[model samples]
Target: MRLKVFEFDISNSVLINTQTQTQHHLTRTEAQVLEQLANHPNQVMSKGQLSCAGSQQAVMSESAVAKAIFTLRKYFGEPYIDLIETLPKKGYRLNISTPPPEWQQQLAQRKKLIILASCMMLIAAITLITAMHQYIWFKTAESPVRESRVVTLNNHQQIELIWLQSPKKSSQQVSNMEQKIITAFNLCPIVKWRDVYLAFSNDMQVLNISMQGYSSNGELLVRNIKTSDFSLQPNFISPNWLQEVSLCD
Candidate 1:
């Protein structure tokens, strides 16, 4: 590995100055220790870790690591000797002046790619959130508002009605009409009908009535009641109104 002016031949235990072509042979222990320090350039490694890296045994004393560092410094000589720095009560660090040029370039490229990928992910997330918000708003604008109520008839039959809100109809008037319809349903027997959906015109007149349920043979059925099909008089409901709205018939 090349570090500044020196080329460390870790496999052959040799260190050579590229400028002067001066070569220095190193011990196996010294080469292992140097390999560890060069691999982690500018980082501290404890004496015990360095010692284990060089020694063949399971454990080696810190003195062996210290001796290797001293020998390596003597070989490095004047200006380059201080490359290995010793910290008080801490550990040793190989203070590489500058990392290898190719390595530095690779690091820069990796960092740029990471930043670009993060920006793309952030943009995609924002776009998805905005699209979902627009979809929800569009659906809300397209669908009409409805008011739902559950009513129990005089005959103790329970039914749920979902009515579309009308611009001209007051809530109180709608409630009165809904109660009248519920009472009229009791005037005739209905089977297999429970949910009703009612629509109203802009002028507050009834538009349509749709009821849904399963038939006697377990088939799904929809019964529709039109405004012209039933009569709602000022003082009374027509006798045939219940028959007109009956699901069974």
Candidate 2:
């Protein structure tokens, strides 16, 4: 039942910063308001909605919600306080602008990979031009149907999650499989991959999950798992299995 916001633990009426090793116990009202905001990060929420969420009444004064927000921001202190934004006429929005240090490092590594790939592609293009006199035959294979969804993080960054449908499986079967994968991912404590791909076999006997991203050392890494070797629950993928495959550490 715990939810994470970057390094913060937004669960059990407590706010914890894992990086700083600091814990802040929240008031009942504060916890309710913060949970509402965390559950819908980056979206504007009015004070009335927030107050009613905490009080569970038809109407609570906006001032109570405002006070709760002020207290939460005060607890956040300095730079982190900016995570909760207050709009004069609109409402409050939880917009996390800063990403963790490891995330920033990962992004830098990805940029280097892109540059190296571009250089390789340029060299290959030049080589192809020189061999233009030779007939180059290329055979293209048909690709499986894919449905992509962009998962937005608390920090406003996005990662693409793609589901590749097996030709033999019905549309409903593929959609249900994708939902199970998504649920497991959503429950993961830490997600470092830039993209994820889930595919099924033509006979529906094998299921493959691939996570594509660069490791800490700037090396391209693909983590794979298959149902043939792993047992899945009737409803969702196992959280332990996800952490084992999805995380490099």
Candidate 3:
């Protein structure tokens, strides 16, 4: 079901800022967290409830669940900090008022449908589609804000820099080049960091990066930077946006 978490729209596996209207991807478990909180709006969802969102990461570890919430807060920034409330040992809840009568009926239907869908594939498909509408019944709701839309990448971003010197190069040189980019960012362990998007632009003379870093002191800084910052040039095809490359090896 979809509902407004502050100015952001909470849809399953996705969060859209109503004003900007840009979609944000949610991990399977994070989606589960929002789903449960939404299911019992204004009511506490015990840690156990949030942890058992029932995705591949079923029964998420406490730390994992915490991380998901951290990510959520970081993305949304400060204005709606109280969108999710914590009740000590009780659990976390969305600080929304009770939904309307029709919403009550829809919730009932969702429960029934969940019980009826026997196939795993069909269930996944439905969950994906279920995000379309949420019938939250509340009056004097916050009006939508207007802001420039920021696009979200479809693929998981793992690194910060891209090379654009030449499309034909050596494998070792390419690997080394990627390492240099990854190492350039002085990422701190205490801060929340995400690799937004890295790509070559301007006739392969510069690299463009859109990234966000949330400091431990609760400062969020975003930069859309283009730089000819690299000192190394490697041969080989350039990396595709959001596809290819596994740095774990």
Could you tell me every candidate's TM-score relative to the true structure? Answer: 0.40, 0.38, 0.36
For candidate 1, the clash count comes to: 0
Model 3 accuracy (lDDT, Cα): 0.58
C-alpha lDDT score of every prediction, in listed order: 0.76, 0.70, 0.58
lDDT of 2 at 156: 49
The root-mean-square deviation over C-alpha atoms between each candidate and the true structure, in angstroms, is 10.4, 38.4, 39.3
Q: State in Å the error of residue 193, model 2.
A: 83
Candidate with better lDDT, 2 vs 3: 2
lDDT tens digits, residue span 1-249, model 3: 445643334544678777667678888767777777777788887777688774444478777777877787776668766778778888788887765799888999998887777566687867766764354333675433211222222233233333333443445644654554453332222323454454554345555556666655778867665555344552222444213432221
User: In candidate 2, what are the lDDT values of residues 147-208, reduced to their tens digit?
Assistant: 88887755444678787756776777667776666565555555567887877776566777
Instruction: Find the 10 residues in a row with the least total lDDT in model 3.
Output: 145-154
lDDT of 1 by residue, 1-249 (tens): 986678999888999988889999998778888888998888898887788784555355688789989998887878888789998788999989564599889999999999999999999988888989866555435456477877787667778888876676667766776776776677656546688887766644455678887777889888877664224423122446555545444
